[model samples]
Target: MGSCIICGTDVGSGRVCDSHQEDVVFDFRGDSPNGLVPSRFYRGVVDGYAEFGVFVDLVPGVTGLLHRSELDRRLDTLDWEPGDEVFVQVKGVRDNGNVDLGWSIRQAEREFRGVLVQEPAGEHRPDEEPSDDGDDGDTEAETETDESADDDIEVADSVGDGESVDSVGDGESADGDAVEADADPEPTDKDVATDNEESAEVDATLASDGDEDSAVAVNGESDGAADEEVDTDADEETDADRERAPITTLGDAIGESIRIEGEVVGVRQTGGPTVFEVSDETGAVDVAAFVEPGVRAYPDVEVGDAVRVDGEVESHRGDVQVESDGLVLLDGEAAEAVRRRIAEALTDEARPEGLQPLGGDETVAALADDLLDAAEAVRRAVLESRPIVVRHPATADGYVAGAAVERAVLPLIRDEHAKSDAEYHYFTRRPLDEPVYGMDAATNDATRMLQDRDRHDEKLPLFLLVGAGSTTESADGIDLLSVYGVDAVVVDAAVADPETRDAVDTLVSPELADVDGDEGLSTGALVASLASAINDEVRPDLRHLPGASYWTDAPDRYVDLARDAGYDAERVAELREAVALEAYYQSYQDKRELIADLLFSDGGNLAAHVSEQFREKLETEIETADANVATEAVDGVEFALLDTDGYTHRYDFPPTPLLLDDLHRRHADGEPFATVGVGTDELYVRTTADVSVRDVAARAAEIAPTADIDTAGVREGKIEFLSGERDAVEDAVVAAVAEAF
Candidate 1:
């Protein structure tokens, strides 16, 4: 861990100096030359290098480095010119103490202030203080299911409440504008936790360059002006120049224009819904029309038909609907190829937990499972197996105040002041300015990522928690007053009123799902880490003298309780166990969820993987069987077929037990099983046999007639034709068995 350049204290996990001087007085005067120490005062210079780099005055001189960079939304329209002086606070001091003398006031005021808040230093009996750790939420919101907005394919629903569609471009209602873009501010479309649209953009761009330039260009222009930005006076303007609707289907696009082009994979008429599986190599949306008497039907409008249907495109809730005007089906093979390409487009957003509708109940259950597991992981890593309570803040504002939070986390905290006594801060959002887990670089960076994700999204009642073994340059009190309250601004993060909260309560209940992120510290665990103080937990105990210092400058209130409960001797052991188990379990679940989602969720490519696997199986079987058949034919060998009836596999020509023993005996001499068949009347054996049946059977994949399942297929040789007797057909006479003779 690197110490803050401004202060000698550790900078925490992120390596960022959190030492903020909130009492920054704006001044353009340079106090030092050689560029003031980083985090020092920003000496606005009349002339300097431009862009991104910070400009600081030389120690005791007017010379300064130029910090030129783009402004964020927070800056709004504030333009800083050369010689422009802005008030800044001292964020850091040279670690050497003699390195330089200016301070950085900007960081301090931007929410990166104060040290991590820990428990109010006081000791108490372990069991004496009540722990409110276990979840008691049984709200109705958790059990309610949202309406599905898709047909044919059931689309995944949102986890949190949907955002309010307030305004849009073109002066039209938001209803028609940003149709597909208005997702909730919490968990995203793909199950990845995202802030709101504004925050989501930032979250997507952070540490990675997402498409931001074009989005910004159009965003800057309002509804009336958006159309003017692009040259529309030209007569050669193509459809591509037009503003694209977010939720549109092939049918709709085709209906509006002459070039109605797309590949159709299959057509199914079931339950009065005439479904057309079509895609334009970019995306695949289920298009269905009402099957009416007047509806025209082609002799073969099955799989692999490039169809051009001039129809209206309508977005019904989460689905894209297309109506047909003139339908033209293309070749089967070509359409099939396009269909496959379109299907791949679903991966654009890696939806976690598959495409299944995500409910509040599932979210809560998942979150709970994640919390409990994370606590255990931390405990195990520290080599301790003890019951420990976990504390998670409800908001993303500031760390929970006092020992009450620690007490709220059960057995983990054990008592009212246990967490505070241990110097761990509880959180649900990002701690205004503190390390996630001590002063480790990776840990701090991860925590920062978590905070940015939720903060920008405007989701949550957000809060960050500090945990045991945490230390910072400034005191928590300093942050609570100036930084956390003023700069962090937790209240601004809330998107809806109490009704939304009520809805969340119903959707995310304790009995359903819970948070689980990061193997050791990702996913929703990041939120828990922020809600509660992170812990490494496996360290030597500090000396406990008669009057020991506390996290909040007070003695631990629960230490006495521990002593009274006869835990003084075992307290240390219990503490170690709690910490380690917490870390281990949490970490394990994080990894599991990540992997499971990739392997099973709709965000994954499992369907593609399985499809490839079955196809390969079919291919292999065919190739191998053909080779064997060729060999048998060249050798002039003949085989006869026999019915397998009245001949049970058990107690037959080859006794199971005796056969196993014989095979084992032969295996010692290296012998393989020979080809043999048995019937009730006689035994038939062959050196070589045609195995084409296996290859065809291997190709018998069940295509999905509906969404979420695509396994069945219908073909001439692959069809199961019932006999004349139909349901009552007897086994005495088989209709027909298509075999290669």
Candidate 2:
């Protein structure tokens, strides 16, 4: 008898009980298919290929065919090779004893939770005696030489009627429920322990390199390069080489020989050259090293090593790159000198010279320190050649914040990098379904960045969170980036919690600056000021963005600024409507060119056309919602309740929030009224009075303590509660609004 490792259930001489066996993945230790359990996962290696399918070896003699029909995608696109390891699931044992294998999407070991070692039954335990058949003795003798047994399976180059085979011995049949008596002898306890240890080590090795599709080549091809760097006799020559060549910035030396010093961030192999991505504080450029065709030159060089290079500047494919004539690794005083020089340049160049917020609003002016810090982080990312990923909510205000940053940073990226498409390569703007950075968004971002770094040798991205990622809800997403040493800059106009301050490298918000009436300041306003600090030359173009973000009543300063910039109230409304319409479709794409034209162009043809549609659709939805609102008194407070799902066009351009905003504005009739747009399980509360949605949600919870109410979408004044307790939550919210009034 034996006990299961997971649940401690007594089993009849096996590692796990039959009930818990399928729950854990097993490493098949035996050499035959008779020992493998059906419907189980196993690690296998690609043995060879055939036109019809790929041959996979689970153990030494156990082989199966992964047919082209079972593949999730086209087989021709697979990157697997003969020696690459993959994961597979056993479908069934056929009547002819051939094992049918199923395709697995998770090819890496990290995707599996646990791995157990499986052993044959009734061979070593005291409770179960070994079989006395002479066939068992012969099976053991055959496996001794089975290491070369797979050589007989010829690999066919084209599709033909090739019969698949399994390792089931003569004593086992397709329907055998128990272990066959002629199976190989069971491994000893010590042997099992050793196998488990070895498996663990292999799994750890694979997991450590899981960020890449394959392993990284840290050790370069050349053997004598390390010796050359460490030679004691070369010290004087190295010092003289550093002194002979004058150091120059990559941006300044376009077509001349210049000596530059920086850290090597990435190393990639090309067909004829080894490209080393070198980054100084000023900018990053590719430095090509040529020892011979397809030979890596610097054998000793690795990522994170500081080096000094004397190279001739040349442009490759319209992008500036360096052709290395002489390169040497720096150490001791030389390395420190490079580090200090880069640090000084980062501090000087990260923020714009003589930086100030775009407008003279004192509330925003008070946040200049944090605004400059945020801009500096973004600028540093640009200089370091890291991608900037902007995540914003799918709203007009959110798009405004995201677009402002995109407008300011795109020009700077173009001016700084020699690559013409650097703007597209380095910047991406994604819209969130809601204004919260949860696990799903974080996992997606991390996966993309990791894959980009692994597959293309791209640097990690700088995540710029606009309109979202400020509350405590976003901590998990931010922490995920911190694990990879990626920095996030959070620019929110909401009253963020203090805990968020600790999560991000830079937190820019009016509440953090102790500004009262901070709710009036939108994310667009904050990011507009920040965008100017990033690039002051784009200041004039971003004047209309802040006003466009305010749907109902814009602050007079931004309104007057837009007017002075030739965007009157009607023209500003046109741009606002045009942007709002574009924000709905393809929310994932930034629509950079179209947005730039709408917001920055002096001519109003595009804005006038799109805004005419926006105004028509929005006014129709408002009139429809205004007819459906029912007035009632809750705790003597006037309440206008509208069924948003029934009254508003759910799929229309002007979304529910904008529709509700216009409905309340045009039909309120001068009453201190609270408008509640109730959906199936969510409620949106908008009032002319200054009432806190967070406070109302708290009070609703107090009124119905068992309703399990939550203040979801707090920035939009939305609440989510149990649909069964809809009446109680509505009554409590109305009462809370009365008290606030």
Candidate 3:
């Protein structure tokens, strides 16, 4: 038998008595599921969620299902996110090694009277005995409770004497009289009013006398001058006690007050407090100050102001935040010093060591300098608490590139900020329907950003464009962002327009690196290397992405890289098909979770399921288009022509561009060949011979003067014309392709 940790009641076999079993929390340290005891509370971390229940990990490799039926509220109403530490009771352990859990009303460790570690050997209280240094093993919860009780007594005593609690203790008077605590009863309203009137009369006499010595003699009678001096000395002593603490070190100082000096990067007004997101050189944290419920606090503290915050550190819903006591804005030399220190630290932390391209692709390696600049820009944005917005084309290669960066930057955001939802707030991936960053996309982005800045006082976001913003066609859109002082970085493998190099802040393109244009590089290959530079800890998760981006003829190095990362060539193909199919359907949505499962999950079930649909849809479209193909000979170069509007499903899967690519591969023979798929107002040109879509459009316009021909997508060789001039435009495009060959 043992005594209970709480209330000292005797127990039959455990540390907790029968009556207090639910009052004490347990930490499961045993290996097997059978070690869990029914009706006993255990701490667990949220592993993941399913339709039926939430999976929680009591220990590594030991998970229990918290069924929805056991919850007091609806499953969807639970605000628990993955990795949160929660409390649940062990309901039962099935014979098949499944442990079932029931919801516990008590969630936090402090809510329980005591805590015990349940191990295979026996149950014991954590650090139960005092150490060699004469320190008791008191948990933080117990210490906080004791401190709170002491503060209540002090507040009560101060109220009885009409003095502030913090100013109660000080040095003795000049005559060697020690100050003693008053044992008088609490003063009534009449007594407080009489004391206030006397203080006001004394203040007026001191101002009228114009004699410092006489005023001091009069003030000393009531101990008013001595009280003022003591308050000043206490304020100075408090300031001296506070050393500048780094934002990253705040977690260790919970329940203790400290001073933090930083710039206010963002300010948000909530229902209870005004939260200021402050960032020092090391990290960023939210400091909340309350005037009243739903009322703004520190109206003078705006974003970009260098300020010092005095607050007690607290943990609110798994996020470490500060409860502000005072906020003082710094200016002149003080503000300059803070700004300089932050700038120096940011530069040192943001600069990467060197560029090591994934798969050792020489084409990407040649652009190391440019890639490093883009990486530095992204890293600095995270450090400064600036949001990052990524825009890419709705294609397999584009999604892979965006997802690679998303996977790398998310962990950094989680580490840099104390908030669990910081990753969702800081990083966003937007997919563009077209391959160009046109005016419509830019206007939408600008409107949303302006609203965020106005409503939440958030900093302007850095726009990262992958696979979509390299050509001159996107110059106007990029220029629009520049007008708002928003920075943009473009990473694409396409042959960029020469003038586009001057449009964006940072441009990473193989063509700009002065390399041969025959590398056949994809956007995913370049951005995956860039993502590695942003955060190298996530490099392993990004190795297979470069190979998965290519539909055909991926480089041997990338294929080998994928193999080493546990992905075979066939698996890479399936992932590519699945992402492409999904990208087409949603086209606009990020599809973050579904895409992550397909690319990162250990099981191949999801990929196989999605890839099967991809193949079935693609093959059906190819078979339909094949029967309508018409062959023609122009200047000894064979051209396959198909009227896409009449023969293909215009609005369904296997989009026109993808279908034309597959049809060209199957029909292209040994001789020089080109495939021209013409629609009502647009046409796509695919050629084996060397050709430029821009040049082809220029030549076709001259051949058919009334057709109004022009290139739509430079990379895809897409040209647009009037519906009435479709026949003329089609004939002219075929003639131009033959002449180029």
* TM-score for all models, in order of appearance: 0.17, 0.65, 0.72
Model 1 CA deviation exceeding 4 Å by range: 1-273, 289-306, 314-320, 326-329, 336-741
Query: In candidate 2, what are the lDDT values of residues 1-741, reduced to their tens digit?
Result: 444443444555554567654444566667678777787778888998887788889887888888888886546545578977888888877766687888875453433333565545332222223445411232333332321221122211111122122222221233633322223333321101111111110000001111222212232223322111212334335434443232335545677777677877777765345778777665667787654334566667777777776667876645678876556677666667767777787778887764565456667787878888888899888876778999998888888899899989998788655555668778988888678887888999999899879865788999999989988778888899999999999999875878999888999887676876546888888899899889888898888788888887788888988887888999888877888888887766677778778777649899999988888888887778778889897655678889887887777677777777777777576667788888777888888777888888888889888778788776778788888887777777778777877
For residue 115, what is the lDDT in candidate 3? Answer: 76
All candidates: CA RMSD in angstroms?
A: 34.5, 17.1, 13.0
Please list the C-alpha lDDT of all candidates, in the order they appear. 0.27, 0.69, 0.79
Worst 10 residues of 2 by lDDT: 197-206
Question: Which one is best on lDDT?
Answer: 3
Which parts of model 2 are misplaced by more than 4 Å? 1-259, 269-272, 290-300, 310-312, 325-327, 352-355, 456-459, 516-519, 724-728
Candidate 3's C-alpha runs over 4 A off are 1-231
Worst 10 residues of 1 by lDDT: 200-209
- Which prediction has more favorable lDDT, 2 or 3? 3
Error of 3 at 212 (Å): 24
Give one clash count per candidate, in the order shown.
Answer: 166, 0, 0
